[model samples]
Each structure stands twice: as structure tokens, then as C-alpha cells.
Target: MSADEGTTPSPLKPARPSMTAAMRSSSFLNDHQQYRPPSKPDNHYGIDTVVEDLQASSINSPKQISPFNGIPSPENPPTIVESGLSHEYTHPNCTQPPGLTTDRLIATLFYKSTSPRVSNAVGPSSSPPHTASSPVRASSPTGADAEIPSNLAPSSSFDTFPLEPPTNDTEPLDHIYGSYVSPMCITSFLHLMSTFPLPRGSTNLTSAHRCLKLDAASDHHPQVVELTLAPAPSQDYLSLADLRKHELIYRFEREWNIDVVLRSDTLWRRHPRLVVFDMDSTLITQEVIDLLAATIKDPPDLAARVADITHRAMSGELEFDGAFRARVKLLTGLSADIFNQLRPVLDVTNGVRPLLRALKKLGVKTAVLSGGFLPLTSWLAGELGIDYAHANEVVIDEATGRLTGEVKGRIVGKERKQELLLEIAQKEGIDLEQVVAVGDGANDLLMMESAGLGVAWNAKPMVQMEASARLNGESLLDLLYLFGFTDEEVAILSKET
Candidate 1:
């Protein structure tokens, strides 16, 4: 037979009805416009496999059925089938509910439906039967006459799905800052908290033995323990600034080298926009101008006189601006190469390099403000990769290549240091609270007082007494702990380059 003659419709297949009568009616297209055929049936028997896997996991792994696995309680049992065939399963342990089982697995995959039309949407009869697996299956509803699961009956009220376990997303923000007068000792953290008086205005501690809430799972630092202290109901909020007012705090500082660091939890959480430093003794061990005066070629005895003047100025015996001018005058007619000669003698303080590298990784802007001259400060700033440097300009005569004794511009003493800090903070679009100032002299006091956190690094008595914190240790890396950074964090930041 020919190909056309051989082709015939199967006897089992029904012919599609013509739509000519319905098409004649105007509302026929509009009325059935919202009608849609059911989705294609899922041609897999994965549900049986999932049920078997869950059964195996429950039996093989006892740890998987942990009581604290964030399952809901039995007092309000979860609906398993919702097909009116309600059954409750109690574990033999009875201490808690067993973790997800085959029934719960099925419940999770098949949501209960209130509408009869969708009630049996995914049941056995909805698709072709599977011969490979013998899993329990419900019958699908057939047209308006077909029955839905009785348990899936419509209710006036229904519970939404159980809420997911609380996450660690808010963990970092939930931390409480702790402050200590001295460097935190990891070994003595818990001991200190227990022995010391509760942080200021802890009126709630009357009933409780401890004032601070120590988080057992805190992972930041073992030495710098994370804690939370609720504000006293009747008293004003306490801050690190108010630390000195309490006699107990003073005793802690004097006796144990410990003082409460207030609101320390918030420090260094966000990267600061600017960090200002006093260049002389802060960045380097020796004062730059004093070093410059010592290295001047033309002056032999000038170093001694200038050294004495510098000591007096740094000790606050002489005013910085006048004393600086006097010391600069002693270098008059001296070759400008004095800075180059002192360059080899310059000693960067311990921990300066690592700290600066870490700060650079964090994208913090660093600058040095000094009463010393620019030639030395500029060179040091370049070596340290400092973003900005400001200092006094020593006028040099082009013919002699020597100092003329007259300053070319404004002096960068205490007042100017404060001004530069303010200008840098403003230019960088950061608040004063985001700025950290470090110094080691009486002249650095003004700038220190103006910054958000002032660190007196091996400073004179006056600077130490007034600054926010004092670091008597030789290492500058200790500053990391003050900002709530652990050793691990510093190490991670170190490798970024």
C-alpha cells in the first residue's frame, strides 16, 4: 500500500470535538479565557526514594535526631497528612520528639490544600502508575465529582509553616563592647568579670550574682571576652568617658591595671575613614627635628643646644611653637642634606609596619602631623605609604642648598596638628569619631583631645594623664586589641597584600 493509504488514526484514540458552535458565541472566548490545563505529571518515583533515604538516615545516624535540631514541640504537633487520617507518633525516648521521619518527609513534600480542586493534585491517580516502587500513595481527585482527602478539608483557621531556626546573621551586631584600662589578659578574663564590681550603674545585679551576661559561644577572643550589660533602669547610660568618676574603677586601674572599656563592642566594626599620628616619637622612636639638628653638617655644638631645647619642649617645660622656631634657627646656614643623613638613624617604632599594612588593607587613610619639618616627615610618610603628611616647611636657599632660618609657611605645632586632623576628617567625609590619633608628647595633646580615640604612646606625664588611653608597651601592634581585633584578625589582614 502507498504511504498515504497506510496511515490511519488509532481506534483507541478519540477525535477532538469541533469548536464551531462555541466559536459562534461571543462570550465563549472570554468565558474560557482563564481556563488552563493541568501541568504535565512528574514522571518519576522520587518520593519513594526520599522516604527510604529518610528512614535510613534516622536509623543509621542517631545524632541526626538531636533534640536541639530546631524541631517544633509536640504540644502543638505538626499536621502530617492533613487527609483527615490524623496520627501522632511518640518516640520511645519521650525526652523529645524524634527528628523528621518518612511521614514527616511526605508532609514536607506535599503541602495540605484547602481547595478540593488542588487537594489531590499530586496523588497516585494524577499520573501513570509506577511499577518499580511500592510506596504509599493517595488517589487523585477526578473532576467535580471526585473526592479530595478528608483530612485536607477546609478550615476556618490554619497554621502557617513553622518558622526557621534563628540565624547568626545578627550575631556581629548583637555583641557588647568591653573596655579595660590595660591590655586584656585572656587567662584572667572570666576571673576579672566575676571578681570585679559590675560595670557602672548595674542596678539589675541585686538579685543576680553577676552583672554582665557572658556569652558562652562567643568566638571573637578568649582574652577579650564578649559580654552584654543591660543599662540600669534608673540611671543614665554609662560610657568609657565616665570611667574615672567611680572610685571602684580607679582602684581597678591602680591595683590591677584594669579599667572598664565602655562601648568597646562597637569599635573597629566599621572601617574608619582616617587615622592621624604624631610623627616625632609616635611613628618613630626618636624625634625627627631633634635627629635633624643632630645630623646638621655645619653645626658641631648646635646638636647639643638643640637637643636640650627639644627635651625641654617635649617635656612641656617650653612652648612647642616658640621652642620649635628656636631649634630650627640653630640649623640656619646648614645644608638641607641634614634630613638625608638622619634618614639612616631613623628607627620605626615596633609594630608600626604591620599595623600600617593592616590599616592600608582596610582602606583607612593615614597621615602624620608633626611640629617637626616636612623634609623628614615627607620621606617617612612615603616609606610608610601614608596617605597625607603635614609639617613645618624649612626655607632652603637655592644657591647654598642650606636652611635660611625663616619658616616658609605656617608652623605645625599643637594647634596646627588639631587643625590638620579636622581638615583631613572633613575632606575624607568622616566624622571625628572615626578618627584615631596617636602621639607621645605634650605638643600632641591638642590633636589627641580632638580625635575620637587618642592613644598616648610612651608619652610624657601630661599627655598620658589626658589622652583617651595610654600604651606604655614598646609594641604598636597592641593598638589592635584596643580596637576589638583579635590576633587572628590581624593575621588575616596581614596576608591581604
Candidate 2:
């Protein structure tokens, strides 16, 4: 089948900005350069498995919310200004029954629906779903006709507020996005909701599992939709829910071509004040060690040996410090000045500049905490204008001007990286809850866990499952949506530099 000819389009799917592998050539492009392979890879896993430093990851899903995941109702509507680069912590326009706690999920479900199963016309022209003051009764077939479980949450608990379809603006949009599943799959969603065991009982598709409050996120840019999941067991992540998410999300992604990332609501509201990155395979494309190994003249297989060790270390199969030391020992007599040759060829990951600019606009401090050696790490930090840089320092022999293959002070292993993160946060006076760390390997896990949000960027399956969140979109800028920024807001911030 042709790339664009998968499922039949729905009236609702075409208006979204998200698209498939075969993106339409933009009229705005230079006429000679308009037909390049689509910038956004198809969300389908087949072609999205791009060759990169890290292995293609295992499945990523939203962090499951536990029964204890409840928050207090706001005294007033949250006052937010998301259209600009404002760093305010306000969340606007939430109203639920007065004096009740609610479990929230800031779901960033994009418009990937493209099912052959047809539904009645629903588009930008349709009215927005009703708010809490006038919530429509839960009406999905599974909810209205399911076998009410014996241990379901009291229906009265969730009946006060009801779930509604996400809202969209009325402006007529002209662009057509690619489709994934039909909105009709909300049928499958309702079924999963009932089967997902709750703390007190089951969802049973009852009113208590209703979606209560809706966020005022931008509806035009294939937006984020925040909902207050009334009667949810807790806000904490649960193992069973995550296992089910892992087992099912992969199938749904492959069969239907959708992306579902679940994150714990633990750091949901805290916008970061500092962002840290692991340099190799994350901020930049290549592993510096592998590059060093390729330069060895005496040993023809030096590159292969070091590459094997580095891969194992990053994969969590080998202890990092031993793996790092083992690789460095192979380079006992290399000229340290090779860094100059290496520095010029390093490729920064796509979206680094725009993400940094947005963070800078928000007055966030930026850092690079790499496990590789430097002057290269420091050089990358300087090139990117990052505020702080830390990495392993190779000891140079005064007699020969070659690397002694020994580290100078302390090794920047996983534990050391965590310590550096805390030190940087303390020096900046930024609270731990306001720091974000991004990386692709096991060494990054500790620092990521300590930060307000830990983003696993095209991570290994192991890292994806452990980090605070996983990012697999076409570009890293998709990260802004995790913080509730819309695509338009991201576009504006990306234009800064």
C-alpha cells in the first residue's frame, strides 16, 4: 500500500496538525527542496527505528496513577498564560464540585485517529464538551452496558462529575494530518478502564471513573488534554497498571499507529528551573569513547572492543565505572590533542538549540553532565552556551603529551553524576522539584529520578521504563507538551534563535 493510503480518514482526524510518514510537501518550502522525506517520521514503529547511538527502545507508556494520586481543589481558577514563554506555575480554568479531592492526568493525546470504523461528524465546528457545572452523563457503550463489578467504586462518588470528549476550537483548519486509530477506539479505552483494577474497586465504567475537570490547553495544535479523573484509586503509579500499559501500548502502537506515554502525576505541576543533559548519545549523536577507539593505530580492532564495552555499559549489562576504565585503558598512548579533530565533527541532536532557547527564556539554568572525557565536554558546553559542564578529565603525561589513560580526580559514574546534579541545584538555589534531567542510558537514571522530571530521549527500553518520562517524537521539542506547552507556543519559542 502507498504510505498515505492506510486507514480511511475521519472528519475529526484531518484537521489535526499531526501527520504520517508521507507528509505533504509544503508550498512554503523552496521549490527545489520541497519533497524531502517527511521531517516527522511516521509514528508507526517500522520506519521510526532510525539508526542512532542508542538501541531502539522497548515500549513507553504513561506512568500509571495509583489510588493515592489525589490533589486538593484549587481555591480559584488557575491563572496561566501559556501562549508565551512565561514560567508561571498557574493552571487555568478548573472547576469541580467544591471541596473535593481529584486525581489528575495531564494526558497529551494527539490527533492520530484514523480508523476505518466511521462515526458521526465531529470537528472544529462542534461545541466544546460540557464542563463540571453541566457535565453530560457518561454514555459510552461499555460504561452504560458493562457488567458492574462487585467491588466497583461507589457510583455516587464519580456520578457528581462525568467524562466528556476533548474540546476543540471552532476555527476552520485547512491542514490534513495522518490518521492512526478511530475515535471509536474509545470503545477499547472504556474496556481497558473497567479491567484496570482500582484501589477500592474496579472502574466498571461507572460515573466515579468519570473525567471531571478539563484544562484550557490549546485545542488547535493537536493539543494536550488534562482531565480530573474522579474516583481514581490514587495519583501514584501502580505496577499492575504499568505492566498492562506496557503489554498493550506496544500492540496498539504497532497495529493502530498511536503513541501513548503515561507519567506519574508526582511532578505534574512543577515547571523546571534547571535542565541537565548527558552529553553522549543525548545532547550529541556519537559516543566519544567509540570515536577515540577509532583513532588507535596499533590495534586494528580497538574500535570494535571499546564499542562493545560502551554498548554494554549503556545497556546496563556492565557496571559503568569498570566499563569506562576498561575502555580508557585501551588508549594508553593516544595524543590528547586528538580532541581538536574530534570536537569539530560532533553533531548536536536535533531540537537542542530551540529547547535551550525556550529554557533560557524561562530563566532556567542549563548543564551538561557527561560521563565522557573533556576538553570536548567543556567545548560542547561552551558551544551550546550551557551554564555548567562536568565530565571525566583524562590525565595527561607531561613527558609525552599523551593520555596516561588515567582519570585526574574522580570518575563521573552514575553516582557521581547524581552528586553533581545536586551540587548544581544547590549552587543555583533551585529546589530539587524544579530540575529536569534528560539522558538515554543507565548512568542517567539516578540524576533523572532526583530531578523534577527525568526525560529518557529515544532511550533504551530499560531506561524508558525507569525514567520519569520517555520522548519518542520526531524532535525533542515535543518535550514542551509534557510541561503543558502547545505546539504554537513551542513554535514561537523555537523561533528565538
Candidate 3:
């Protein structure tokens, strides 16, 4: 091909050394080579520059670029950037085959190019890269765009994303209830959230509303405030499930001795028709069965045995029915006179009177559903003006004035408790959703599930897991606050009474 004669370009050929091989050599030099002060900026450009230069020079003299081409083999492998994106080195001998455009060649050389704008997207080694020019992906079905910061996406190092308010207007609403021990000042609650944010949504930060205080004396027993938080951009709506999944919420609960309730506050205000309470630990401080067994002839030994059985039953380790029968047998021949003696020790839990009074004011029915005997439950219900009582009966021998060691009625285990809840709900002419059940033992779980809203009051682990809301702090009156009532409203109602 003489210079004077018009010569056609030789058909393009694949480079002698693969692009990957060239990239590896370049990376090796960059990593291991000592920097003797550079005379010019390295440009820090990677594989693409070499490829373009090679293609350009290949148009003139292809043979001269071969010596520089290094085939990447087992002895010399490609350097993989930890970010999962692979970069390749280029050689002038590496000329694209005929008909392949530069974009097509780059697309083939790299595994597969998604979009041209992706080149502007940064990999681990690339700095000051711009975001893809393309519009962001559409918002999710939840109307929240989970846009991960470009800096965070490549390396995969992140604990959480900072939540912003959702720009969209159609998201469902949610509220977070933060409750603590009495006299919980509004400022204290705010400080707690600022210190350890559980909900991390604008709704929680901006829409906080003080709910009714459970202990009417806010000056002394101010317990809680309800904050109606708005959804964050990443999360269109929050739920109890969302709160539980966050580690900060659990930490907030443990650290502050606070109980958090995330729910639709509106629905709970409808007022429960029947608020069924577990007689043992929930309504009263002691387990009636354990208390009864403590009065046995061998007080220490028999009480220990009965207490062990009671613990197992409440913890859900042993079946309540079998444990109940076994416990009653242990109390065989125990004097019935002990009931009178034990009556004084039957401490009605704190806030019972006020909670009961409030329920009565609202014309809401109340009941005591117990696995314990009627002797105590019936008496307590009557004491508190409870509308109904359902419990096992301990047969008393008139002649001896002692327990006959037998239960005369059906045993009220978990199933019976649930059945009684349904019975009470049906009798009240209300739907199941119009009932509230509070209990602390495993037996109370089914009844809790049966009710519209279940309150686990200082409950066992299992009950806590299953219940709708949990109260770790004291005061059954906390129920009113949970119902979205304010201290002023409760005070007015108390005055009306």
C-alpha cells in the first residue's frame, strides 16, 4: 500500500492482550509503585482512557501497540475494585471490530452498560461523580422513594437512612404514644425523643400532641403524652410493627421505663363495651392461687410448691388446666377461714378505682374473668362495682369450714377466658372490636386476642409479644390515656361523677 495510492484501512482485530489484562497491570502499578513527586496530575483516569487512546493510535500503527499489551492469565489476574464494579486497562493494539460503535464497544468491554448516564455514576475508585442524568425511579407503591445517597450505595456501609417528610399527599396517617411513670413532664418526653429518636419521622417530631394524663393529678402523677407523628419520605406510614422493628424503640423502652404505643388513635376512642381484666396479677397484685396456697398447713413448703406451679402456668411452661388441678389438690383441706384471713392481703392493684370509675362514667361495662376461684374474684368485682364476674368455684365444706379440694365449676383456662370474653361481648350487644382485655399471664393471651385492644399489664414475655399494647409502668388508669382522653377530660368526667 503506497502512500501515493489510496489505501483501504486494514480490517480491525481484537487486541493481543485482553482489556482486562491491561487494567490489572495498570492497577498493580498504581497500588505498588512508590509515588516519586508527580510532574503532572495522574488524571487518575482508569480503564476507559486507555481504551480510547489505544483505539485512536490503532487507526495509525496497530503493530507498535502489541508489545505494550499484557495478556491477563492465572499468573497475573485483574485487580477487582471492592465495590463490585470492574475496571479494565486498554492497549492501542486492542482495536474494535468493524461496525461496532464506541458506545457499543464500551458496553461489550464492560459486562453490560445499563445507560449512558451510568458512566457519570461513581464506582468506588471514581471521585466527584455526578448522579445519573436520568430521572429517579418512580416512587414505590407506598408512595415513598427510598433514595439511597450515592455515597452510601456503592460501598454498602449504612446503619439507617435519615427520614424526611413524604412529599406526596396521599399517605395514611399514624401516631406514636410515649408513656412513662407518673409526672412525666412534656419537656422530659421531648428530651427523651430528641436523645434517642424511635420513630424518626416528621410526624413524630412535628405533630406531637399531649394526650390525657392517666393519673388525674398531673401536678403529681402526670404519666404520658400522645404524639401524632406524620409519615417520613422513606416510610409513607408507620405502624406498631414498624416501631418494634426499630432497635431504638426497644432501647427507648428499656432506658426510659417508658411504653410506646403506635396505633390508629381514632379507632380506640370508640370506647370498649366490656373491659375484661385478668383477676390475678392484672387487677390485683398477687396470684390468687398462690395466695391461697400460702395459707396451707405447711405454709413454707406447700406455698413453695404451689408458687412453682403457678409460675410455670403463668409463664406458659405448664398447661394451666393441669396446673390448676394440681395446685387445688395441694390446697386440700386448707381451712376456708383462711379466705377471710387472706382477704385483707388481696391488694387491689393501684389505679383500679379511678379506672373503674372512669369506665362507669362512660357507661362501659366491666367484668373480672379469672382462672382463680370465685371467692376472691367475686369479692373483688363486688368491691370495685364490676358489672360481672366469671371464675372457678372452690367448694367449701360447711362442717369443717375447709376447702373440699375440688373445683365445682368449669376451669377457666386460656380457652375459657377467651370464651368468657366473647360471652361478655355478645351479652353487651357489641362487636368483638368493642372490647378491651387486660391481663399479665399466658392464660390471658387468647382473651386478649379475642378483644379489640389487648393491654398487657406487666405481662410475661409471651403475653407482651402477643398483646396490642403493653404497660410496663404502673397504673391501670393508663388505659384512659391510651384511649386518647386528656387529663382535662378525665377531670371533667370525675366532676360529673
Candidate 4:
């Protein structure tokens, strides 16, 4: 029955193969029977064979044809398929699906690939041999065909990119001297004034007489008669009591006057080598601890306590050890991070830049022997270009990043300040006679006393009285005169600065 049916064409022809199945079979045959050039000049003839025959020949043959060129060879030339013009190629058996575009390919190469071309230039073997066929990705943002926001981009936008000048006006002003100041100038001026010797003998008495006589004559003048004056003594001759009363009046006027000290250019000509400075209320206008307290969150009262301790210490009412310990205790649990955060807000005193600049020019080996924290003091020293600096370090908790409420190293007290001053002088190979110390508070007495020259700048009554020279109503530039800077030199500095 099957023979008869096959012989007599069936009503339905053999079920036509599905289009997909036919295509698949055709592709398979084409791949298997694909024409290959001869392997060598000896085997140059092309052989036509069916799929089965070609399969048998391929298995038997020791060499294959060159896919690149029509000529056959013993070495098979690699098959390089130009898949597309999209700057990407695909590999066979990459079964992880498709639809990857050029951009994705480039990004994947950048982030994932570590081939020679994509290797970091900063690597140990920086200069790798270049392969022409190896794909090179652009190293700069501009060369990339992608969008990136300005702020989100790296500061160095591109390694090879050109840089433009700053556009804003504030850029230049950022470097000006108004940026930072040192507090040493005033303290030094005040200390100097205190030690200045007064004219001796009855010169003081003669000055008193001149003031009294001037007053008496002014009282009798037609212009003076209209003005009020002490009643003319009823007796023609003056008694010792009258002279004493007159002397007291003259002395009161002299002491109270704002311009009490005379300006003498000669006095400043004598130069001083060593200068010592007080830290708080001297070099810097504000007590660092007090300012630090104010910056603390949620409590304002702590700032007051810090200020009190600072005042007592400066005035010598409390021993430095007791005051410093008490103050540090108040700051226990404070974060070390506060120093960095509050540095920008610290108030640098006025006239510090000019003073420090002048001192530096004079070849004075400047130092800051402060009672403040080392971090703050060191920062100031670096900023001001001071040669030497010694200050106490605040002990900080490594884990919690908080202050331990204790100083880590030596306490820079009155005695320590003096010691540092001597140490610095000895190290610099300078004698004490070549040194000058300046400070505004009682804590600075030891340093001031040790220096050959001591100046007080806007100091307390006690400090002012003890200092050898006092500077009032002048910029710190005047200190240059004390270091032998002439008017011409000062003018040149002012211009250069």
C-alpha cells in the first residue's frame, strides 16, 4: 500500500518544509560546503564537493584556506568581520544577548577593560608599547560624545585641556594683606614704652611750673577773664601748699592727655634683635578659647567661663596652671574638628601684617611663645612666616575626635614663654642684648624682662608702666623705624606690599 501511494502522487504533496526550517538547512549546508581557497601553491586547484564530501575533506586536510585572501596558506589568516560602522565589533558565541550600541561599548571598555590602551598612565610601567589596532578611548571629557554637568565634573576637566583665567574681581582681593594679621605688634610696643626712662631731677618740677604759669597768665588775659579760672590768691606771695596744689594740677593734665609721649625719630633708630609676644589679647585680639566657646552649639555660658579664665590668667590673678586646667576642663568633650571648622572665623588682630613683614625684613628671628593650643598657634606661625613658635597642645581622643580636657605636652606659661625666648636666642646664635620682647599682659613679664628691648603696645596700666617703649597712634609700619628702616625704605616697602 505504501509503495502504491508513493508511486501515485499523493493528493497532498509532501508537506513543504517551513520557510524558517528551509532557511536554517540552507545556511547549514552553505557553512559546511563554504568555498575555501587552496592551502598552498601545490594545492591551488579549487575542489567542488557536496556538504558531506566537504566535511570529510575538511577533517582530512591538515591546513585551511586563508579567510582574508582568496589564496590558501599553511597559516590561517584571522577572520576579521567588519560587523558595522558603529565603532564596535562583536565576537562569535557571545551568547549574552545583543543591541549594545557604540556608546555603551565605549563606557564598558573604560570602566571594565584593563587592556594596554586603557591601562592607567600612572601605573608602575607607565609607558606601554602602543598597538595601532588597539582601540583608544578619549581621556578628556571634551573628546567624549557624552553630556556632563559642570559642577558634577572633575576639577581637572581634562588633563590636556587649556585653563582660563579667573573671571571674578574678588579673585585678586583674596590675596591681599587684609586677609590675615598677627597680634605681636601692639604687645611689643607697650613693653618698650614701659622701660623708657623718664627725664630725671626737677625737670618734672620745672614742667609743672611752666604749666601753672601758663594757666595763671591765661586767667589774666582779656580772653581769659571771660573764661573761668581759679580765684587769684588773696595773698600776694604763694605758699608751699599753693605750689603743691599747682604741681598736682599740672601732673593730672600731663598724665591724662592722650598725646603724653613725644614722637622722637631718634628713639626708633636703635634696632632690637629678639622680640617676644603674648598670645591672647596681644598677638591676636580675642582669646582663642573664649571664641571657641562661642562657636559651641547650644550653650553660651561656656564662653563666659572661658573668657574669665583667660582674663584671670592674663592679669596674673590666677596661676597659669590652675587657669589653663580649669579652662581645658570646661572644654572637655569638645571636638577637635572645631579647630578646622572655626579657623576661618578666628579674628586676626589689626596691624599684624605690616609688623610681621617689617620684622621679617629686619632679619629679626621672630617667634610666638603662646599659651594657646599648638594647632592654632602653628597655623598662625605658618601663615605669618614666623621663624619659631611654641605652644601647648590640646589632648584629643583618637576614637571620638574630642578634646580630653588636658594639654598633651608642655604648658606654655609665663616661665615657659621666657624659656622659649632664651632657647630661640641661643639657637639663633644671638645674645640676649640683641633680643626684644613685647607683650600687653602680666603673664608676659618674664619674657619682657629677659629681652634687651621690651615694648608695650596698647597695654594694660601695669604692662604699660613696666615696658621700655610704647607705641601709640601709629601703624605697625612704624616698628620698621625701630629696625633701621628709613623713610625711603618704608615708602618702598609700602609700595611693594
TM-score of each: 0.54, 0.60, 0.56, 0.47
Q: Which residue pairs clash within candidate 1?
A: 82-151, 83-151, 84-151, 177-264, 177-265, 179-260, 179-261, 180-261, 181-259, 186-223
Judged by lDDT against the true structure, how good is candidate 3?
0.62
Q: lDDT: which is higher, 1 or 3?
A: 3
Give me the candidate number with maximum lDDT.
Answer: 2
Predicted candidate 4 versus true structure: per-residue lDDT over 102-153, tens digit per residue = 1100000000011111222221222322234222332422332333222112
Encode model 3's per-residue lDDT on 146-173: one tens digit a residue: 3332311221112222333223221111
lDDT of each: 0.58, 0.63, 0.62, 0.51
Task: Give me the runs in candidate 3 sitting further than 4 Å from their true place.
Answer: 1-206, 214-222, 231-248, 268-270, 397-401, 495-497
Q: Which ten-residue region of model 1 has the weakest summed lDDT?
A: 103-112
Q: Give the residue spans of candidate 2 off by over 4 A.
A: 1-93, 96-99, 110-187, 197-246, 249-255, 264-270
Better of 2 and 3 by TM-score: 2
Top candidate on TM-score is 2
Can you give the lDDT of residue 24 in candidate 3?
Answer: 66
Residue-wise lDDT of candidate 2 within 1-497, one digit each (tens)?
98689878777545657757576444334337556654443343543354321254454565787674445344543345677755534322233356844444433343222211111122323332333322132222132333321111111122321233223223211111223223333344445544544655434323212221122342322223332333343325455236424665444433333344454444434377899999999998899999999999677989988987886688676899989988889999999889989988898888888988888887889999999986999998998889999999988899999999888888898999999999999998999888889998888999998987788886765676677566654466666766766556777876864
The candidate with the higher lDDT, 3 or 4, is: 3
> What's the lDDT of the predicted structure labeled candidate 4?
0.51
Better of 1 and 3 by TM-score: 3
Clash statistics: count for each candidate: 10, 18, 11, 31
Candidate 1 local lDDT, 302-327, one digit each (tens) = 77788778766776668988998888
